[model samples]
Target: MEFTFLFSQFMSGLTYGLMLFLVASGLSLIFGVMNILNFAHATLWLIGAYICFTFWSLMEAHQFALWVSIPLAALATAATGWVCEVVLIKRIYKRELHEQLLITYAMALIFGDLIKIVWGPTDRLIVRPSIIQKPLFLFGAPIDSYFIFVILIGVAVAVGLWWFLKYTKYGHIVKAAVYSREMVGALGIPIPKIYTWVFTLGIFIAGLAGGVQSAIGSVTLGMDMNIIIQAFCVVVIGGFGSLMGTLVGSLIVGEVFSFAILYWPDGAMVLIFVITAMILIVKPWGLFGTPLRA
Candidate 1:
């Protein structure tokens, strides 16, 4: 019984960790490549969830509601991201960090308000589609099939990203731009275009996170702020702009939250900060983070 209980917790933690990784990876990628700390990221996620819910509700009679809603919601969020990058973010690249933060933070507020206007004050949820609604028995335990699907999606995303970065030409350009934007530009590459792409990619991933999250819980007003804190912590502790670090940090935060909630319900949220502080005390730059420019 003890072993089975532990296994259940482990699976739960792993499922949640994949979602965290999905969200954190985008933030890390944006920060590493474009040096933008996008405060609007979680807002994009919230919008995604709301959009997914809306779409699913509209198409509830459809047999493939989940499949239809997810991509549509993600595309909507990506369009929002594209507009932000092309219009607002493009103009602010040379601004101070505080200025960038303030603008993005304000955008987050705007998105929150927009969501309220559209979805109202009610908490929304997207039910797991009937296709994956049944529980799968594993190790004498019934596990949610949707959770398993989410985990598999996360793994696929990770592997896809790795392959894209390693084998694709644009990926190579992005990497070069990361290390030396000036050099890449000097070599006739359009660095601004790259930044736009990076921003789009970042928020697109955030949107996907939101779409996935719709299956797990309520899409409430403050959901943006809720995940943003942990996303920031994950990136900071795992090393800013490090994809693998985001994965590691997500696992740490997710598992810590899972176990801590089991052991000390009140401290579940607090323990993540405790772990972040400990990691920073030892390696101030984060486990895999490169030194930042002063």
Candidate 2:
């Protein structure tokens, strides 16, 4: 019984961590590559969740597969991200920091309202594929299949992202741009175009996370603000602009909440801050974060 409980907690923490990584990676990458701190990230997440629900419903009506809705949702949210960049974010590059903050906050409110208007003020549940409804056993310990599905998605996204950022030419360019956009621009690279692409990637990641996660529970109001705060916590604790840091931070925060709640349900969430403080005291920039440059 003890072993089963421990294993279950570990698996639960792992899935939660992976999902946090999916969300935090985008926040980190956007800051790393574009130097823009997006305030509407959670708004994007909620929108993606609704989009996922809508597409799945439409597809199910046509007798299509459930998994197809995930990509469609991702694509839709990615497109929305692009539109936002062109219409809103791009115009504010030279604005004051407070201006950016206000604009993003307003955008969040707008998106949040839009979600309520479309989906109504009720909880929505997604119908996952039939295969994921059962639990699987590994070494006599039963693990939920949906957890496995989420874990697989996390692994694939992590591996794919690593490969893209490490081996591809565009990846190197993104790195170079992150360090010094001026240098890249002087070398005849179009920085504006790169900015669009980077923002698109970040938003796409959030959408994918939302679509995958909505399968596990209800998609409802205030989810955007709730998860975004946690996502920001992951980014802040891990170090701004570091994907590896985001991953590590997500694991720390995720596990802290998962295991802590078992022992003290009311106090579990506070551990996230306590552990983050401990990490910050030792490595102020984060576990894998680089020191700031002039």
Candidate 3:
């Protein structure tokens, strides 16, 4: 491949990686705090896309509409997540992982059906904002403005979350919980409330990811399945629930998929799995993950 081709491929990889990071970060946060696999996470993302599209369609078409719709999408998904937690998930906090997974898996079906019932099975695309439809030159290659925004947004979120987790009182409590859940509960920290906050925060991030997704393409029913598999791969490779690991793992998986598609399209899907398996064999806890002691 020519140098220019390789450079373009790298850029593509970076963009895709950033997208994966946003989605995976939410998954990691939820798992890290709650020890539950949220089957409805990806569905929530797709819901955000539809919500954003609908909101934008209702408003006067302009930059203002774009700005308004994006936050609405995020907030709407967050609300759904909050409801899901309060109504069903809260009761399962002490259940085994497999049982939790079963409940959530059922929710995934319920969510998909709800989407179909509400939005129908038809494919719907969002209109990209004028601000994001243009392509800007990056290293002499034309990069889509929407992809650039995705990358910037991912970076901003990573930084903001890092600061929040590292500097806040909640962060300290979370840190304690991570090490010893029983002890933290004993210490008089409202464990249930903390879990609620953490889970809601995770859902909010997932919703934000979905909102960003809307700008790139139409919201479709299949997106939930598509993104969930990728997000799982990211979490596994990054070490079940590690934030920094999610970031690094996302970049690796994204770039690998991008470059593989450019060089050998057939192997693209299997490549991430292959690499993840190798990483787990060598370092089961992942690059940034810490194995818990019995």
TM-score against native, each model = 0.97, 0.96, 0.95
Candidate 3 local Cα displacement, residue 12, angstroms: 2.5
* Stretches of candidate 3 exceeding 4 Å from the true structure: 292-294
Model 1 residue 232 CA deviation (Å) reads 0.9
The candidate that wins on TM-score is: 1
Q: Clashes per prediction?
A: 0, 0, 1
Q: In model 2, where is the ten-residue run with the lowest total lDDT?
A: 57-66
Candidate 2 off by > 4 Å: 61-64
lDDT per residue, candidate 1, 1-294, as tens digits?
A: 387787778788888888888888988888888888888898899899988998899988787997888888888899999999999999998999999989898998898899989989988877776878788878977777888888988898888777877899998898787788889999998889999998898888888888888988778899778688988888878999677788888988888888888999998888899889999999887888888854
Candidate 3, residues 1-294, lDDT tens digits: the string is: 667667767877887888888888888888887888888888888888888878888885676786788888899989998888888999999888789999999988998898899989888776765766777777777777777778888899899888888899998888778778899999899998888888888888888888888877767888889778888888888887678899999999999999888778998988888998899899888878888533
Per-residue lDDT over 36-104 for candidate 2, one digit per residue giving the tens place of the 0 to 100 score:
788898789778888999888777754345588888888999999999999998998778878888888
- In the predicted model 3, the residue pairs found to clash are 125-218
Which pairs in model 2 have colliding backbones? none
lDDT winner: 1
lDDT of 1: 0.86
